[model samples]
Target chain A: MKFRSMLAALAVLVLGAAQAQEPIRIGSFLAVTGGAAFLGDPEQKTLELYVERLNAAGGVLGRKLQLIVYDSAGDAEKARTFAKRLIEQDKVDVIVGGSTTGETMAMVPLVEAAGVPFISLAGAVVIVEPVKKWVFKTPHSDRQACERIFVDMKARGATKVALISGAGGFDKSMRAQCLQVAKNHGIEIVADEAYGTGDTDMTAQLTKIKNTPGVQAVLNVGFGQSPAIVTKNHKQLGISQPLYQSHGVASKAFIKLAGDAAEGVRLPAAALLVAETLPDSDPQKKVVLGYKREYEARFKSEISTFGGHAWDGLMLAVEAIRKAGSTDKAKVRDALESIRGFVGIDGVFNMSATDHVGLDISGLRMLEIRKGDWTLVK
Target chain B: MSGRTASLATLAGIVLLLPLALQNNYYYEVAIQVGLNAIVCVGLNLLIGYAGQISLGHAGFFGLGAYGSAILTARYGWPPLAALASATAGVAVLAYLIGRPILRLRGHYLAMATLGMGIIISIVIATEDRLTGGPDGMPVPALAAFGAALSGERVWYWVVGATLLAAVWLALNLVDSPHGRALRALHGSEVGAEVTGIDSARHKVKVFVISAVYAALAGSLTAHYAGFVTPAKVTFFHSIELVTMVVFGGMASTFGAVVGAAVLTVLPQALTVFKEYEMVVFGAVMMLTMIFMPRGLVPTLALTLSGRRLPR
Candidate 1:
């Protein structure tokens, strides 16, 4: 009888422990390999650091945070499959992932169907446009980036622009947005040319744009080596027009790839790139610099805007969880949408029912490359 | 059962049992992808393995079918079934037109021509922003039949699985038929097949058109299943991957093609948990498999198990 009583007490203790230790599961899929590894690697590192910090601080709502990550390798099909697994198999409460626009768009239908809150890190307008009920993103959309660039161009008295875009999804979207929003920004596109992603020499396209009349500025829309090649080719061709690049090339790697040619080339980027330069009174200054310092210190590498995206996504989800005071998906989504004036490393997020991303044009800062380093335009 | 019948039975058994074993939506989704790829590989095997023709542009046909159906059903409001049928027919016509000229070229020339064809198609799709939604791709509508929208991976699993089985059965029967004999003759030697009263050009073009239709059908199913279509699906890399599956499974064997598709589709997904080591492991696994099983996985395994050469 005494042994039976002891066993019952042990069972009670186990059940109580299980109930008390129910962790908040956050699942993510990133392009941690393949062509988009630069974006995903830093995002993965940020999530790891954030989760460690959050858990060490006694977690959210008195329960530990559990992070489950999958490597998508920048494949849309892989992203879709991983999204399903995160939702159906892992049963995660929240998801933050799809480090590229293609991969993020692929997971939209699945996330919508499952009714899970998805915080995307991809920089595309389509991911949040028309307002997916459960979907949100951290990075400013390509459209926003275009608007920011055009606004800066207008301030610089540039009226006509030449567009040299790479034939990739991000490039295509930015190119379309540039054409669509140019008139509104009082900018006219004089010439539009495209090069393949693998094209190393864009001198021919740049020459055509250079010959076009009324082209005051040349804007290149692409990510990775293509933009760098365009920069090099533009200089090689000796085009006197100022060059503007899309936010897709917002990294030191692009400057490094372009070498001396990247000097004076301007692009709009997240504030994290110039965190140290932000005014002390700015709300996002401390958060951005703190993240950059911690990340660089821990990983022994410079932080990029891509990692800032992951930081904003994780913090947003945690904030929503705390506000909702429960692990319920619906409540968390509502809380996410209702979050206002939440200063994150990306921007001061003010989420609403219609605006999922919550960042405006002010979120992007005009940056120019100076001596192979990023410098904020005053 | 005969060997052919036994293989068919085994395939059927696998198709029926896979869903039961993998009850989650993710597994069902992966299974559906395997089935779609298997359908394409089965047709590609017939062209590359049986007919002795090299096509580096099958993904062009796949893309044509996807964009065709997506544009029709999503934009033009045509019925999904009609769109699928018309897309398949269109791809067949396209294949026939291109095949007549390209099939006449031999060896590397033929390979280059097909490669050019694939690249041209993808470029057109990528550049034509007004129609094809440009490189950002466009969403596809859900496939509906009998007034009910087909949603969920479970439903697609059955549809895609049955279609794959039908494809395999048709390929097997074709392989055993007189046309199959003539193609095999051509594969052995084009001059010998012509001497034996086989019209080599006619058979080559016919196989090309048929394989394109197969790829088109698979592409249509995939677009509807994923509910999105992109030029990435029609790129040179995708075409190469499809051809590699056929070669990796053992050319000319219908079951081999299916097995090849299943393995290649599942391998990367299975290795995703390995994170940074995933690609390294995947490459190493593929290299090891190729090095050890040079004749392809199924035929090599069959040879090892039965200790006799299997007829191709």
Candidate 2:
């Protein structure tokens, strides 16, 4: 019996080795296991859906793309180690994920040293600006999001505003950019307040904002339940100012978690949410609807701009691998840098060697939650 | 005396040889981090295991060291090594002042006070944008010793391993000495140790300050290696994580602390298979370890080997 068992184990090991040699490996580190799981879980699903679709379409360069994802749990050091393991041990063709700028930045040196093409899902400018040759991003920068929001605000005549942000990497960058954009647009920021990531109550900050004079719009620049808190508090305190949220609050999960308070908040988001509202005659409408339909059909969950970023990231990686015709890091990086007019879920992405952020503010559309449904604000 | 001397020699030998053996840069990076964690855990063991105290606020000291080194070098143009030394010293003094009143509290009260301290530190780091770069974190000066950037992984491995060896040697010697005995007595029975002429409160405070200095040094080293520092490093959860390392390894055993640091650090990497279930698994591990191996991994194993096995 012992001899038989040993023989079976040996056979299984041989088969495993053979199968491992066939797949072209890729890796990413997400926050799937941490408090950020609310975001990372959807990001993971987005990657999985892309991988499935690509593999079914004969994959890139005729090699099956195998994604090996690690959970950084929103910690920076863990992200670094995962990157090392991916580059050194797994020998992946490319890397393509990060849930936050801090976690993404932690792996910058490692990817640069390994000379692999890294596409970040994180939106902070620090991840792409001061761009290393190997790193690229698919998500619109926080600055681009800020510019888009201000464009919509200018249209809405929300010239007087207040800013509130959580104390984290993404929130801080968005806050700074919002202030800068407001300055550039000749609008006034009447009040500013802050909260930590885990703070359950933000009433004090909201109360301060509520009492601030001449504030027409309250811009909440953070993710998770904070946008809802801001909206709820605005109504509870009987503050009549329009609440304009950043793209971080674009998730349906945000509204669901925020309950009834999430109704009527406005924000600038990617074209994904307003697909149904857009005219069939519009050039982007078909692509947006197709992606939304396919993503929803596969995952059975409502997709957000956050997942849209992941889709863009994965599709770009696949395209680069196809163009390079090989998994060599240098070749793949050149392929990514030279990519042009790639119609993505968010926008038409065009990459240049000097500019790593492929998409700009033109990709965003003004959106508002009216009667608990996202609608394109004309 | 012979045992102490031999152990010290062993530590020195390992420190000297580890970098040479770990030619791969990835493992070298891991070694550097393990050394840094060991340094902090040694001090933590002194507090929780020796002095009969608990703290969930060491991340505050850790952050202080990181921010202190970062601000001094980046803002004030101080030399990196000098800044690190000052940072460690500053955290030690802060810990000394804080330990006086907070150490007087017993049990969970002390834990909560320390937790508050960590939260305050992180908040200050996050909010003070102009000074500390806000929550986006600030860049740190590279550790350059006498004109050379300490960029190579092998070089860092040796530097951190040597630091850990020295810390382990000192802690071991301290744990075996008369002062060590007094600490253990206090750990066993604080009132009894006081009754027997030991200055329990003073010893507790001293160990608390020592532990904080160790954590500060570790934090400073880590900041230089990463070349960045964020408020995340100083968060209350991070303080709890450090405490978890000490308790998970075995409070009374220095080897246990090292083992604990290594296991906890590596476990996340191995558990990548679980994907979204990773946190659930990690929480389960913490709960089971506390319930089953309350004395921690090292001491429990030691007891089992010594024919004093705990019942399953």
Candidate 3:
């Protein structure tokens, strides 16, 4: 009986070792509980859903994918600590995370030092501007959004614009980028106004913008409820100039919060926002629609662009791992940079040595909130 | 050993031994954060606990230090050490000037004044995109001393740990000094302290300046360690969290401040395992702790276990 028990234990150990050898580990830290939960929750859900689906389809590179996620709670310090834990303790091959700009930037130095591939889902340009060897991003940058919006405005003959921005970090960066790009595009900003994040009303700022003569368009740059409030206040104050919001307000929640006031408001957003509306010729439509259907079905909620970012990040990492044919960090980093013509939920990713976020202004489609629904502008 | 010496020694021992207990870089990073926060709280305790003054704007001084050091080092090509020293001195001078008039207010009036000051500072930093980099914040150059740039969590853990010990020692010495006596007298009652010939206004202002300097030093250290500075560090919420650490640790006791910082900083990191329920559990834990120990965790636990009061 003792001999039989020892043989059984040895057999169990062998099976366990074999099972662990072919599992690929992907780690992430996201703001799952704090202010950015709206972004992180969807991201976390999408990563889980895709990991399950990918495994069911026989996994990548003949290995099952394993996910390890931590809640950063929208704190930069927490994000840094979790990034270290994921790299040092969990020994994850790649990190896809940081729901906001500040958190992502905080982790940049650490991940670079650790020599791991980091694919950030945040929308800040700085995360990839310098192009750290190990760092890449999936979201459309604020700079791209600014350029797209300005290009559209220039085409419409809206030369003079007024800028109203929120006090948050994302809005501040977007506002600066918009100001910088406006002059290049031959657009003049007439008035610049700012609002606190918790301000209940923005009519005072809107009133100033309305009073500014030669202001052909009003551009509102912010995230969350502030942009929505600006929309409502703009409509209520009867500012007849065209209202353009930043891509920060791409979600359905903005329309829900702004009520009928969101009608005719335009912004640049990921192609995922109007996946179903895209024509058959558009490459992103099929990939985005597939993700939207699967995510909505599994989670019982509408798909968000934030979730598509997660899908793109994970798929990019998986593609790199498959191409590398090994979990080696250096090889995967090279593979990620060299990847080209890969269609993702966000857009076609074309990474290069100098450009980590290869998607350009073309990745963002001009979307208008028509009757509280996202409608693509031709 | 005297109680003060014994406590200081115990703190020193823990600082030396903590790395052995930490299994990875993440714990060291968290420990470094705790040390930085404890430095601020220890000084804050002097103002609130000893001087009986409230400052809802302490983070403003902290921000000033961060931005001052960052601007000097990153923009003007000044050495980090010189910038840190100058920034700290600048914060001290600013605090002395602001504290004179604002420190005269009592109770909620003082609280409101401080809150206003913090909001004003935050707004100025956020709006001034030319110098301060506005709300997106600017990168801080790394600290280099002894011809070497500071890097790694282990190195920062030691630097911050030693700084925290020195801060605690200074605060403890002050508590045992004549100024500390006068400050405590005012904390007991301003009328009573005035009757005893204590210049209550002068003492309050001095403590406020000292505490501001402490927060400034911590802020400078943090900016160097993290290599980034944002207006978020100087926001009103950060000010409240600093004050809360002082109160939650046991106001009068220096060790309590350190304990409070350590527990609160580590608690959230440790609770991240709970995932979606993490915040709910954290709130419940805080509520339960406050309910059971009105004097805070360290003091209340000491009283219950050894039947002795902590040194004020």
Highest DockQ among the candidates is held by which one?
Answer: 2
Clashing pairs in 3: none
| lDDT against true structure, model 3 | 0.88
Question: What i-RMS does every model get?
Answer: 10.2, 7.2, 9.4
Model 1 chain B: weakest 10-residue lDDT segment is B267-276
RMSD of 1: 5.0
Per DockQ, what order, best first?
Answer: 2, 1, 3
Off by over 4 Å in 3: A1-18, A183-193, A199-215, A232-241, B308-312
**DockQ numbers for every candidate?**
0.32, 0.33, 0.27
Where is model 1 more than 4 Å wrong at Cα?
A: A1-20, A203-215, A232-241, B1-3, B307-312
| Clashing residue pairs, backbone N/CA/C < 3 A, model 2 | none
Q: By DockQ thresholds, what CAPRI class is model 3? A: acceptable
In lDDT terms, which candidate is top?
A: 1
Return the TM-score for candidate 3, rounded to 2 decimals: 0.92
**TM-score result, candidate 2:** 0.91
Candidate 3 lDDT tens digits, A1-378: 134235536855885687865478899999887678999999999999999999899998888888989987787766877898898767899999889888888878888889999999998888888878888999988888888998999888899999999988888888877888788889898999999889999999999999999999999999999998999999999999999999888888899999999999999988888888899999888898898888888889988899989999999999999999898999999999999999997789999999998787788999988887999999
**Higher-DockQ candidate among 1 and 3?**
1
lDDT for B290 (candidate 1): 91
